[model samples]
Target chain A: MENRFEKQEEEKQDWGAYVKPPQTSRPSQESEASAQSSGEQLQRFEPRSETSSALCDIVREHLHALVENDGAIRPEQAAAMFAHLTICRDCAREFDELNRIVSVLNSMPLSPLPHDYSGLIMLRIEREMGGLYPLMDIPPNLATSSWTGEAAQQTSQSATQLNNRSLAGILSQTALPLWSRVVMLGAFFATLLLFLTSAWGRATLDATLSTVQDWLHQIAQATAEIPLLGAITAEAFNALSQSVHLLEETYLHIGANAMRGVFLDTAIAMGVYFIYQGRQKAKRAG
Target chain B: MRTVTLVEQSDAELVRHTLCGDKSAYNTLVLRYQRQVYNLAYRMLGNAEDSGDLVQDTFIRAYGALASFRQDASFLTWLYKIASNLCIDQLRSRKTRSALSLDSEREEGREPANENRCNAPEDMAVRGAVQEVVHHAIQNLPERYRQVVVMRHLQDMSVEEIATALDLPTGTVKTHLFRAREMLRGRLRPALEMEADGK
Candidate 1:
């Protein structure tokens, strides 16, 4: 068997030059089962001519075959083709390269849409088309239009009573422009003072350092007894620790103030500013 | 009352009805195209939430612009053109916004390392590294190459279909695919080597 295999391998290298007939011109009706029983199959496996590179062309085409889903070459005629690739280093490398390309391509991070994606999309579509609520009309008993005159009058009386009872209800309808002005003035002063003290004045950092320094110093002293310090070195360590504390305090204070001033407070001021601007514009237009 | 089944009606018929003041018919068209729209946007954007919003915006815009669409063009093609143009606009805006964010991060001396870390792996470390390299490589590709690569490889659109969708010449589509493959092949060389070793 080994000898036969070696003979077959040698025949492939030398048979690369056969005058191959056109593939389509070959007998098409040579069914697989019939070819298996007849000696015609073995004749088909005979090596190509020793002068033609038809076998090499087939082998290169097999490179594309390796990239295909099955990765298997078919037909008894392809036996000689495989025999050539087994011995040819270039063909083997080509096969390896094709396989490598596919493997790497598969390894790419492809985030296909979520699995329940179709269902979720359908759900959203349904929601958008009509809300989850069932579309039923109000029953006649509950319908406002069906109410008796006395009942309607009582409903209106209760609504007016409810409306009259609350100071907010009256004030909301009444003109409170003077009161709003006073309130705006108050908010302006408070925002101005808060911004100056916390941001520009840096008072928050000072206050926080004064608060946390005692705790920080005690902890530093406790840690200073460790071997790395070498000596009490209190003055140097204390100064170093104080500076660290100051740095941390400044960072926290600045972050907190920015959160307040630039984010929350700025939003508030912008709202107030827009209201003020709108009022001014209305007055000018009026 | 006869029920107008969406499936029984052609898209152009639905649009005609919508133009004739049948709001439900227009909404039906939105429902029909929303999936394809969302998939296209998501594949284009690489993020799901943004893609969903884009799909909604696409439908809303399509509804608003439905009257202007000539009946000569297929409704799907018209909608696709609108969606594609919006996606291009979105990509441009996102680029500018990303640059601003990067500048802000640099100015603050705090790099946004965690941005890339969201999709980072935890246990599959080796696979994670390979995925990271490919992700960055894809991200680094020129926009045209990236778009074609995603459409061809990810969406599995045929070259002809992609050309039709993008309104590019078929040869241009093929060239883009070829270049994308070469660029990706170069970037994934190490992974290719590992795969060859059966690792």
Candidate 2:
């Protein structure tokens, strides 16, 4: 096997030429598999014509950082690279160059700031923010931390209270004009209505419902291993599936498309909801 | 002592203070991380002025979105994410505006201005802001590869941290870093030869 691999490797000129060696090398996969199954050690041959060079590529990647910092490559791959380096003068030279490159990269100086931009940053923040937040004052002294514990508590209470504002207040924070949002919302609803009322929309809704039902059933099955939780999950999934089936039945009577609109609408809605939730979470944490 | 306590407050605490309507807390956060963020930006954008501007933009954006930050996560990692995205966006915009100055930089062997003078007597030309040569080599790489290289090698960010910053799976991050270094090895061969000569 080893002799054959070496012979194949020697014959290949370009890297691309050695792709289909296994067919030529092996008598048949069934004979090989059956031979292995008969309690024989079959050497678990890889097409070494490729992997010998492939190992070169893999190990070269591993040698990107000489020491494998942060576990750059798996231990086995690293060991392989180290072994290859000792035998292959070319890989060793490449490794040396790689090591020098990394060392040089590490030796680079922390770029000096032209000046301490902290003062300029604070001043810019103050000047630009003067009119934006009438309620939230720019800290009195940008250079000093004058915010006492008591002030933090009181201000935080106000901040928490701030989260309770109406949806309009949330909408106001966004740069989108009210008119555009209204148009978008209206268009969304219209499209949703058209999907639900149309035949193609009905088909889409039915397909989507069935897919969701399958997912819920699988989840229900997974939960069944947990005893009490599984029973509850099974029941919940049954109800959900029944509801989806009922919707599908209703869609058959009326109209709807493939699952396309559902995906498009759900994706858009999920994007908007996640963005809103992220902001809310950030606000609460902040 | 009180000042030290404020200065040393955990990022989460500072974030909480900022959310509580204390602008000072946000400023404190900025002061703590500005230099670090600036360093990352400089590495990514390959220019001092833009990196400086990105530092400010990162802080301001972080400040605006402070309420959205998860306290459990490292604030610096989160800041790096913000700075990294801004840097990539700037890099993309710049890519369309003009060709990278790599060829010109190579011809000039332009060194970084105002960078600390190389103290290591062994082959300063190969090791020093002769950094500009390397930086330009880095600049010449595709943005995705450029980002991972800067984050991993230059910023000293762990692979996991880079994975998080770039929203990539760890395996993919490793591949990019490896391939990026492989691409870089050939570009940086001259420096290694220069080092060999100095030896």
Clashing pairs in 1: A16-A52, A17-A49, A17-A51, A17-A52, A18-A49
TM-score of 2: 0.52
Candidate 1 iRMSD in angstroms: 16.2
Per-model TM-score of chain A alone? 0.24, 0.29
Candidate 2 interface RMSD after superposing interface residues: 9.4
lDDT of 2 by residue, B82-112 (tens): 9989987886676467555432343244433
Give the distance in Å from residue B27's predicted Cα in candidate 1 to where it truly belongs. 2.2
Top DockQ prediction, candidate number: 2
Model 2 chain B, TM?
Answer: 0.81
> Which residues of candidate 2, in runs, are more than 4 Å off?
A1-58, A65-69, A72-77, A127-286, B1-4, B99-129
lDDT of 1 at B113: 51
True contacts kept of each: 0.04, 0.26
lDDT of 1 at B60: 63
